[model samples]
Target: MKKILLPALLLIVLALAACGNKQEEPAKEDTPSKEQGTSDTITYQSEEGPVEVPANPQRVVVLSSFAGTVHEFGVNLVGAESWSKDNPSFDSFLKDVEEVSDENIEKIIELEPDLIIGLNTIKNIDKLKEIAPTVTYTYGKVDYLTQQIEIGKLLNKEKEATEWVDAFKARAQQAGEDIKAKIGKDSTVSVIEEFDKQIYVFGDNWGRGTEILYQEMKLAMPEKVKEMTKKDGYYALSAEVLPEFAGDYIILSKSDTGDNSFLETETYKNIPAVKNDQVYQVNTAEFSFNDAYTLDNQLDFFIKSFLGTK
Candidate 1:
């Protein structure tokens, strides 16, 4: 009788343990899978609409102005447009990046990019989309910093972009305050670029550090530049009237190949800013874009040029 009772108790304990194990098995199955946590694609709310892109893009190709922004985000850039590749500041970073364009479908296809970025004005949109997840931005649709934030969203690096924008704005505004103190509260600045034998003056939103100087730094824009560039964001005029656009300080963005014979002219040399030695000359290649990398470089240049500090 004792042997039979002990065997029955043992069987009951073994059965209870089996039931407990079965209950825990379903809980494990109900939990999320590793594959579900790491999806290959994520939907991005682009300017055009929602488009699916790689969650962690390993290969990216930029066909327009966002190369610096993308590169600054630390994404792998397999290809970029000629302008970005030719930028002297980007030389070391883009040394291995292939030079591509909107028209080069075969070359782009060979790169096997998982993501492609460009302006809305690019050609062969449908063809590019067929090859990879393609996203395009309309120029000036958003402010430069906002554009960087948007790129960060696209790259899943919004936090980093937002941090950069906040820090940069503060730095630029402080620089502006320091410069204004040194120069004067009423001192005005003008951004002038020489391209294609034509001279142009820019407003706040235009590239060429105009955004940094007028928008971020809160520097005064010459009234003539404000009036002329108010309509087009930039105004083209002859070098003879360059003095009319001159200000207390001038940011001269010059292209290496552009005809800059005007710089040697008496009219240019005689301008108040030039004569006062307030003209800050920057290469168009280095100063053209408002991307983070370029903007930082521009800020450094301004600090060194204005306050004479590194």
Candidate 2:
């Protein structure tokens, strides 16, 4: 009887050990990462510094005046940092957002945000992280379209972002076709700006020009402009070089106070674009700044400009 009891007890112990092992094993394949608390995890890289994000952030605080991405993602914004040049349209989108400070770490901490997003150039990232997960984006990382996609990825709305871009592209293409029909194919245009008494011609690669010149009209690149862009990619070039690399049309951009004073100058008068009265002025807000809503409006105006309806 003792031998039989001993063997039975051994079998029961082995069974118990097996059950314990099974319980200890983690169900890797069966469980989803979302349920594993990965949604709050924040991950971002930028020229500014390393940012660690909390998992599945609920309330987010944004510390930048440019909240174009918020509208794109339709995320609830808890706060935004005020910039000197905040766009008025941003007010409608950010009606719910509170104004955070550039230096006020305590204010950000009080919000209890799950994450924080801002430009890497901002100096408050480390301080902000003590309060919540922080992510930074470099300005040079993407063109405006790609930037929207990146923002979507961070917000976990990548599909929506992709669709938005596709819609914009289709609209821009249709607008482009309508525009080219008016200006005629093979017409070349220059993006000109006179700021602070200095003339600047943005290359085809310029953010605004890239959309209008590359995407909209499919205009040809100027040889000299291409040469300058070969190095730093794109920049504001001198307006004085207009005659040396004259274009068929000069789309001039002006400040609030700019007038025909350039027309009074001999150099501006001598330029082929000016001589033909081909100079066209665009608003600074629409073209100079590239945001989701602003770009949409600018694209329409560019279509009009090309159609000769402006």
Candidate 3:
């Protein structure tokens, strides 16, 4: 009896030992190793500091700007600010995306985004940080082209961003030369916008094709206008002062609310640009973005408007 009991006990102990070995092996083939788990995330240098972000983020949210850029990069978006929701190009892609209210923190938190991109001026930034990793950009701190590149770097797509910038620069240079050939090289251009209460003249980087006109297109600005706006980025003037800022060619940006009656007035009509039929009116909704999307659209507009060839 003792011999039989000893053999049975030995068999049980051997079976238990085999099970313990299997558990200790940690199922390496089926389970992710520590190194593999660590690889799922990466640290990015942001305006605030180094931040850990997903190595391959599947959900991203853009709050105030750069929605166009993110879309251009083929990244998946989980939400967007109300402004992008109205963009015709973004409307379809954002149909399912939640519209984040810039004024409301709860709206953003509900989206469960892995990342959030916005302008530095956005309100409630502290609350936004609580929801996800947030990165913010200050407009005018860099040129539009550089800003886009910075955003691309933040998203880990610097290569694509740089490639696009190179291509766009080449295209813009060609367009500038073509425009200068069509219109006299000496001809000057101005970018102006009429808001509800004020008129503004912009320099090279404040959107409304100013970058393309003054920087990329190499279009000249009137000496007086340059002296006033070159440092401030923009000059605000009354309707009566339109002629002072007007150039040989004017790109006028208007929003839905601004009154266009000023254009009919003799003051505006008498400007050389208006008299020469060189005032190209563009919608603020379409022309205000300082992103690649707006740049591409405005380039075509510049060609058609200036060269009369699409």
**Residue range 1-310, candidate 3, lDDT tens digits:** 1110110000011000000010022232422111112476656665566666665677898876677788776678988866667655556578888887667777777778888887665678888788888887654445567666766766677788879888888888898999898888998888787655677776665656777777777888888777776554566789898888888989887666667788789999889888888888887655666566667778889988988876
Ranking, lDDT, top scorer first: 1, 3, 2
lDDT against the true structure, each candidate: 0.74, 0.54, 0.67
Off by over 4 Å in 1: 1-38
**Total clashing residue pairs per candidate?**
0, 6, 0
Report the CA-based lDDT of candidate 2 relative to the real structure.
0.54
lDDT of 1 at 60: 96
| Predicted model with the maximum TM-score | 1
Q: Report the error of model 1 at residue 306, Å.
A: 0.6
Q: Which ten residues in a row have the lowest lDDT in candidate 2?
A: 9-18
Of 1 and 2, the candidate ahead on lDDT is: 1
Lowest summed-lDDT stretch of 10 residues in model 1?
A: 9-18
TM-score of each: 0.87, 0.69, 0.83
